[model samples]
Target chain A: MLNKIKRILIELGGIHRFVMRFFRELVRPPYEFKEIIKQCYEVGWKSLPLISLTGFITGIVFTNQSRPSLAEFGATSWLPALISIAIIRALAPLVTALIASGKVGSQIGAELGSMKVTEQIDAMEVSGTNPFKFLVVSRVLATTITIPILSLYTACVGLLGAYLSVNQHESTSFVVYFSQVFEAVSYLDIFSLVLKAVVFGYTIGIVGCYQGYNSSKGTEGVGKAANWAVVMSMFLIFVEEILIVQIIQGMRT
Target chain B: MVNEREHIDQHTKVITVKGVSKSFGDLDVLRGVDLHLFKGENLVVLGRSGTGKSVLIKLISGLLKPDTGTIEVLGEPVDELDEKALQLLRLKIGFSFQSSALYDSMTVRENLEFPLVRNKRHLSRNEINSEVEDVLDAVGLLHTIGQMPSELSGGQRKRIGIARTLILRPEIMLYDEPTAGLDPITCIEINGLINEVQEKYKTSSIIITHDLACAKSVGDRIVMLLDGSFERGGSFDEIFDTNDERVKPFYDYNFII
Candidate 1:
């Protein structure tokens, strides 16, 4: 048991070192701008359909689930504001990140892990190209920059779903519903959403890259890397959410 | 048992490994191995499976470090060089992996163009295209330039792998089992290509292989790696006549010449 604990600590240290190296290399020249743009298309644009679907469903389900309790208190009219705040402040960003942790994180991990096993990463290094910059830095930067945008897009789609769900029973106009949705969301809510997106994006990219880059030799190792990338990223996302919420609460006090 | 030091011309030494030893976990792969390569010579290191032939080449390329001793490539100590310095040195030395290691995500043309664009970013698009075309044409795979690595046969992938390295016009080529896992006809073609490449580019090389036919045809000098160090070093004919029991098994069977 002690040995296992020691191993986990050592692995954590390795990941910390890997992240430090990534930041150091991130600022160096030969910035790989083209690769970064390509990764953005891959991580952000390609993920739109899935994010949209999930966001829409989350908004509908959460609204439907909350309707009975609100109706009991004769508060059905407050549905738009309640749904909008919940979706924008937390659900949209969290759901988008979790979905992306499955999609983008696994892809990055599997692709790089296979590269490492096949020696393509070594080939890049031997050919005068920095593999860390070309592979890890580009993907990480793309995720960091794109996830917030994706979350914002998801929040918009989720609100549309919530509006439609509200119209299913009540006779609220489209304009009134949207106005209430906008009125409930403050700059603080938007800022927190964006902050959470950024943290979650960074976590996904780094964990995926670290697992893939340090993948052991063989086919089994590649699978393990992909699996670990998803699991660890999801775990970190929840941890980040708790910390950010606590900090926001502290500021409020 | 053989003194290979006399064969090296000190002034023209391109790579020198002295008393180098390496181990992974408990297994010692290379133990105090020493060797040298002069300019414009095909030096082959022959060893059985997992005898650290690949490890030696990797050490020279600075992909792996040794536990002890030194490897100097083009007069710079590879172990001591920083990442930037090592990357600079790597631009001059091309390594063709045993598995080809072509980027599966990129097409053949893109793979060939990677080194050129990274190393010589100033070249115009047309210049890069022509250079890519020329290297592909040399390897006789110009028509397949647009094809992915998965689309190519084992032989074609190997050729494209070589073309990718040749695009850089490296001064030294380290081939790790270049002709492994190919049909006999493809093997001969690759060996011929190796000879042609050495002559055309005037590139000194270290070809690591267990293929006796490849060693005899492509090697100007052959060294047998046994135990940990080089057991013998000489022309193929000289080593073929050796009475050493360990080296005899390699020549016991008649190989296709």
Candidate 2:
């Protein structure tokens, strides 16, 4: 148990140092603008289909599940507002983050890990290119920029799905459902959602880069790095979710 | 093998690694390794697996820092220099990895163009295209320009890797186990290319390998790295001519003579 705790501490220190380097390199000149744009396309555009499908399913299922509970209280008409609250304020961000943590996180890990083992990263270094700035900084910056946009997209898709589920029973129009959603959510919810997505994205990027950059022992290490990237980022996302939700709640109260 | 140190004052030293030591946890990879490379010469550091041959060149490239002593590349002390200075120094030194280390996602043209685009910065598109074509043509892989690294065979990838490094036109070349996994014919071709690169680029080089034929074919001076530090140095024939058990086994196992 003591050894495990020590190991965790060491890993955390490694991540802290990596993040510090990212911030240090962040302000430095000769920014890799092209690479960052490419990564944004990878992180943002490539993730859309998965995010859309998952968001739609989440919305449909949650609305169906909550219907019986609201009916018991004879408050079935509150379905739109309640579903909107659940999906926008919490569900959308969490689902988007978990999916990205699996897809983008593992990808960055495996890609960088393969490069690390192959000496491609070292090749870049010897070629006089700043591998960290080109690779890690570009990726992290991409995630930070894209995740908020993805989260917003997820919320929109999820609400549409929820509306479909609602429409099946009540024959409600799209106009009424969207108006209810807009009424239920506030500027605070929007701010919190964006903030949570940014934090989650940063966590995923940093964790993935750290694991893969430090990967060793060849092929086995690549697999391990990918696995750890997903697991660690998901864990941190949950922790951050709770903290951010609490802080927002505190501000509201 | 004779412990022969030849005339040193004739040529200028481009890289000098003195009293360098490195350790990884309990393993002592390099211990008091001292070596030098003269300008425009191919020096082969011959060592069996696990003798820290790769670590030595990595140290020279500033990829890894030595725990003790100093490494001077092109008159700049690698250990003492800051990151920016180290980066500038690294541009002057080209390292050809054993794995070739070509960016797997990039096409051969893009891979060759990468170092140039990053370092040279202000070169016009026409100049970039010209330089990329020149290096690819030199490596005889101009046809593979459009193909990704994954599409190329081992020898092709190795040539492209050398071409990528050559794009920067470095003053020094470090080939780490250049002929490690290739067939005998490919090894000979790679050795020929190493010699060609030296002559064409006018670059001092260090080729680390265990292949006797590679060392014999490409080395101007050969040194055997045994048990971390360099044990002997001289002409390939002179270094392997003795009955020393440490040196004799390598010759016997490789050539079986």
Candidate 3:
């Protein structure tokens, strides 16, 4: 058990060092603008469908599940306001980040791990190109920029799903439902959601790149990297969510 | 076999590894290995599968560092150079991998253009195009310039790997098992290419291989690495004709023919 703890500590140290190097290299010259734009398209535009579907499903299910409890208090009218706050403040950003942690994180890990195993990374190094700058920095910057946009889109689509669900039972019009939802949401909630998404995105990208870049030597190592990238990024996302929620709550008080 | 250290000019030595040692965990890959490569000479290091031939070449290229000693490539100590300095130094050295290591996402033209794109960033598109075309023509693979690495055969990929390295016009070339998984005919062709590259570019090189034909045909001198150190160093004929117990197994099959 002690050895396992020691190993985990060492791995965390490795990740910390990797992140520091990423920042150090980020400021260097010959920025990979083309690669960064390509990554943005891959991470943002390519992920729209999955993020939209997840947010829609989550919003509908949460409204359906919460209806009985709210109806018990004879408060079905509060459904739009409650669902809006839940989706905007927490669920949308959290779910989008988790999905991206699985999708983009696994891709970065597998791609880089295969490159490392095949010596393509080493070839890049010996060929006078900075693999860390080209691969890691571009992906990280893309995720950081894209994940917030994805979360914001998820929040919008999720509110639409909630509106559709509310109209199914009650006689609320689309404008009335959306007006109630937006009336309940403040600029602080939007700011916090975007902040959380950005942090989650950075964590996912860095973890994936670190795992894949330092992958062990084999096909097995590539699989392990992909697995660990998903696991670690998801774990970090949940942790960040809790901390951000607590911080936001503290600010409210 | 006598060492050929006396014949080489010290000033012409582009790469010099002195008492370099490396180990991973408990396995010692290279131990106290000393080597030197002069200008425009193909020095082939012959060893078995696990005899550190690849490790030695990686050390010369500064891909891996030595644990005990120093390696000087083109006058600067490899281990002491900073990241920027090492990257600049690597621009002068080209390493062709056994697995080709071409970027699978890129086309063959892009692969050949990679090093030039990074190091010679000031060149115009037409200039880069001509350089890529010239290197591809030199490797005789100008026809496959549009294909990706996955679309190429084993021999063609290896040729592209060489073309990618040669496009930079490096001063030193380090080939690690250049013809490892090819057929006999393709292997001979690669060997011929190695010789042609050496003659045309006048580049100093360290070719690591287990293939005797490749060693004999392309090497200006041959060094036998046995049990972690260079056990014999001389001309290909001298090392081949030796009767030393440590070096005999490598040449035994050739002798039976």
| Runs in model 1 lying further than 4 Å from the true structure | B1-11, B253-257
lDDT of 2 by residue, B62-166 (tens): 999999989999999999999999999998999999999999999888898899998998999999999999999988889998999989989988999999999
**How much DockQ does model 2 earn?**
0.95
lDDT of candidate 2 over A1-253, digit per residue (tens): 9999999999888878988999999999899999999999999999999999999999999999999999999987899999989988999889999999899999999999999999999999999999999999999999999989999999999999999999998678899988988999999999999999999999989889988999999999999999999999999999999999999999999
Worst 10-residue lDDT window, candidate 3 chain B: B1-10
State the displacement of the C-alpha of residue B30, model 2, in Å, after optimal TM-score superposition: 1.1
Give all candidate RMSDs, comma-separated. Answer: 2.3, 2.1, 2.2
- Candidate 1's residue-wise lDDT over A1-253, tens digit each? 9999999999989988999999999988979999999999999999999999999988889889999999999999999999988988889889999999999999999999999999999999999999999999999999999999999999998988888889887778899999999898888889999999999999999999998999986899999999999999999999999999998768667
User: DockQ for each of the predicted structures, in order?
Assistant: 0.89, 0.95, 0.86
lDDT by residue for model 1 (B126-242), tens: 999999999898888999989999999999999999999999999999999999999999999999999888878878899999999999888878998998889788888888787
TM-score of chain A of 3: 0.97
Q: Can you tell me the CAPRI class of model 1?
A: high
Residue pairs with backbone overlap in model 2: none
Query: Which parts of model 3 are misplaced by more than 4 Å?
Result: A1-6, B1-11, B254-257
- For candidate 1 chain B, which ten residues in a row score worst on lDDT? B1-10
Better of 1 and 3 by DockQ: 1
